[model samples]
Target: MLDDTLRPAPPRRGGWAAPAALVSVTLAAIAGFLFLMMVTGGLLRWSPLPPGSPADTSGRVSLPAEVGAPGIWTPDAMAHPIPAAAVLISGNTWYADDSEFYGGLVGAGADDYRVLDNEGAAGMASVLSPDGRRLASGDGILDIAAGRRTPYPRAWTDREIAAQAWSPDGTRLVVTSRPVDDEPYAAPESLALLDTGIGAITELEGSSPGLDGWTAAFSPDGARLAYPAGGRIRILTLASGAMLDIPTPGGAMPAGKGAWTRDGQGLLTVAGEHCDTCGDYPVSWTVTTLSASTGAIAGPQYRLDGVYAVRVLGWWPSGRPVAVAYAPAPGTPATLFDDPGTQAGLSGLTTVGTVRVLELTPGSDHAELAAAATESIDVADDVLAAGTLRDGRRPLTSVDRLATGVAWFVGLTAAAALLTGAYAVAQRASRRRSPGMSTGIADSV
Candidate 1:
């Protein structure tokens, strides 16, 4: 028997250690769970299936299998394939692009699509003259009646005229140009004035110094030009080089060239707004008009009901706006790019539907949808061709990328905390089991 005087002390339980570790584990787990949710949410956002496309629980868009093309649809020249750019319908005739490739201009006054045989392979931005006698394309003016080309002088032929709009009088042309193969004019010195009568080329300098030039439309009276840049439409005076900026509503930037109202009092274009609360994808866009004189919003944002992915094409003769809309069966959400944060306020959505012309009428407070665009998967391309392809398609804006980065950081931090807390608890338990530890037990002598 061991001596009574030499009794071993009892091992003391850590009074605060276990409970503190448990508390840490609980808090860390909660944080980690929140972070996990954020990461999953980001992934789901760009998944190919979403609430607005195809068939969804939202019941906005649902279609049968025999409807539009599936994953990828082959485009045909005879059919009105999705227009690659600008669309204009005047008189009884409509002109539109049959493809993005060269010499894709097609025209139709009747139901069938016909190739504009007189169109050349130059791929210049072409617009019909006021009298509708000729098509002015780039530095080369195409005389439809004569079936001949009037080339600009060698001195006037350096720049690639990307976009041009004829003045109401047809004597002047407001042209936007870039390098030869650069489809969208991105250069700072892209604006120029062309005097058609004398072939005089005057380089103008009123475009946004901070942004690349997109769409340019001459005012009805030829006194001003309205174009979109950096979330606003700028009206530049031809005589004084003065400029006025009109901001789009809901902080959405103007997309495409500003479409002039018949009275030239308002400018129309598609505008987009970002939504953070939207689970996977976070952008919503619609078409609206801005008053030229006062910069006031003329109406509510017009969108196709249940159609989330739509791009403004231009206006029709009946005063309706046309757009290319995409709707697929709802599934997972996915985007064109992993993230499209640099595409200035673009929603970064890829569509699978057809073009829609909305019949919205202006009213006292806002515009009302007089008649919804017909849901036709196929339509012949008539009277709506022969201009620069100004389809407003782009990726995400910088703001969207910033939001993604924030979500990732919070998730990572929470995961680290959870892991560290678990490691600390294990270390404490291991220390308690070491041989050097003594138990508080008495030994009888």
Candidate 2:
């Protein structure tokens, strides 16, 4: 009874549908783009969000500004091609500190770094055993090829072992300890030698006072332990149980870890510039050798002219002392170092300019610039602060990550709904034009 022209209009979708759908798709694309931008904020260098985003979408975790000088073989270099915070060189292979908190062995020609894990292997403050087949840490000793860990002696359970060094024969460990049963563990009160074979412990006590609990370097023959006590180098002869204090002129304090020379005749140590008239902070530092026999200063005291702080890494195979030097961060007040509360330590200081390497020959009064690091070293700050381990980055809080997911979901859902609506409308129009399709709903007759 109704003419085709007058027939009831085919069901029309909402007038706002098309425009709203288009707007949603556009918004979704923008959101997806922003997410991508956030993901690669550092690589390509633009961020969609203003300076302060709820998430820490920022720079990439990159290698140190520069690699160590060629042939220098630094841990940062051995971690090469990746970055490592700690490295130990044993002969030809390099052991780097990886996630296990122990050393991960990697060879120059090897494909990957090796890690070890087992019951007692999980620990911190790692050092490689002399045999190169074992790795020792605060918790236990890991047998590299065996994938096994031997826990420390039960007697050390209640004590916090602060420092450890292996005997040259790989049969013993010299450790310093302090009790940690609830009370704060103070400077090491006891130094002991433990025979790894039988687990027997021997106390090294001759002067009543304990050696530096934080660090001790063994002589090449393992006959003595060289430590710092009250700004002087102390050599403890294990065979005779004698303690000798090496006097340093001008009240110079030991600045970093010391190592024994290849010949073991003198000890390598970095000394702080003595300032009797000044306050707590030393103005500069110098690398010098001390006579192993008498603890007397020997050789030239090579003072790094512009270096503000120094870390004596170890001795290179060629007997050159390997060290990392740091300069003050730009704009840091010159007076900052003078303030004890200003928050600069071995690990916390932010450095400006390229970190330079210094290799001083044992007897030289001057140092050779081994190599220059490519970029400034920022020791403490981290960039990938907002991803998950499941993702590539450290995670933001659960709520923030959830919100990011939801935003993505909503954008996509809106786009899907828009397309679905358009499809339904198109199907209706197609049926009307074909003339054979029927609206399934028939008249109530």
Candidate 3:
């Protein structure tokens, strides 16, 4: 107290330290939050949902459901249960509860679901060979066409069953069954030419290499069969008994699903170049005369973009120029469904004489119904070629295609950004406490 030279140091108030520290921490947190908001918001904003998305909102994951048997509704085959084992003429006529199994080929175009063992459906029976003639329908089956009844092989034959198809002449049934039995034709997959006329089934010798499945399609002339084997395009000659693999550019041929051209010269892919998952599906596909007889890729690969689920819109009687229903690229200046009436009239795709063209209208979305095909889906080229096209033919938008891709990326990008920001925030908190622990925070500090 007596020393005048000692002056007290300025007071460092406790309040000052607490406020300053708090302000600094708040500012840091706000800055970090803003940085995160800037990056995360913009990053995911550009994502878009793909076109043609299903009802699934859980992203690509699908949940399984247990449903009871669905009803079988059909005009031709009503008062009976369509066999879960037979070929269904229409998709609407089968059990919704069961997965895709054909209504067994029976009845005057009707049949019951057959069980294996050739006994009553209670027995373990598989698909019967394409038998045109049957006096008594197999258990749970019916008879439709005119054919004599014959007994199936006693022991289960080696033949593997495939999706059924009609031959060009309608005399034979082309189904993808290999060897007609398990022993001789071990290749479990082959296109079998069952001669309904002569009652002889010939296994087409040269398969398009690895081509399997019931998706095997035949041209109307009974000459060529187009199939995808081992993810490549190939054509088989029914007449010549030859299978030639088509050459693709750069790498391998597209392994997408394929359909025949009207003339049977070209094939359509369900997806195309951008569709990596679908293996090249597409809206349009044509097999031009661009290939040599040797089956080489000669001209530009013709394809239409953004279409799927190609149904038999119609067929030209001349055997060329099929009528296909397709929508335009999803977002282009196009309308959806093109009225369900609109059809693409294609020229060529036939060996018949006159130019094979679709009967399209100028202003209307629906196809200009040809006078000949007015009664049915098959339009005769001769009757319609000289026939004029209706006015107002315009293309519609294909909704499903673009949506598929857009939706995938949108979800992916959003999830990525959100997860990234979450990780960043967690890392900042750890850094404030530990200073240098995890590599992520340690580097930042």
Predicted structure with the largest lDDT when compared to the true one: 2
**Candidate 3 off by > 4 Å:** 1-99, 102-159, 178-188, 205-215, 224-245, 248-271, 275-314, 317-445
Q: Model 1 off-target regions past 4 Å? A: 1-99, 104-108, 111-126, 130-132, 153-156, 181-189, 206-214, 229-231, 239-242, 250-258, 274-283, 304-354, 361-445
**Candidate 2 clashes between residue pairs 3 or more apart in a chain or in different chains:** 65-374, 65-375, 66-374, 387-393, 387-394, 387-395
RMSD of each: 17.5, 14.3, 19.8
Q: Who wins the TM-score comparison?
A: 2
TM-scores of all predicted structures: 0.46, 0.51, 0.36
Clashes of each: 35, 6, 58
| Between candidates 1 and 3, the TM-score winner | 1
> Which candidate, 1 or 2, would have the higher TM-score against the true structure?
2
For residues 1-445, could you state the per-residue lDDT of candidate 3 as single tens digits?
2322434444433433344445545555555554454344431121222223221222211111111111222112222222212121111112222212322222212122111112211000122222222211122223333222343233215544433344444454544444543433312255455565455667653453322221355564657766555544557787777877664332222221123545555553322233333223333333232242444543333333343312222233433333333232323222111112221111001111111113222121323232110001111122222232322111011112223333554455555555555665675575467533222212221
What digit string (tens of lDDT, one per residue) describes model 1 on residues 313-386?
Answer: 34545655444443422452332211243332112112222233333444212222111111211111122222
What number of backbone clashes does candidate 3 have, counting pairs of residues 3 or more apart or in separate chains? 58
Evaluate all candidate structures by whole-model CA lDDT and list the values in order. Answer: 0.42, 0.46, 0.32
Candidate 1 whole-model C-alpha lDDT, 0 to 1: 0.42
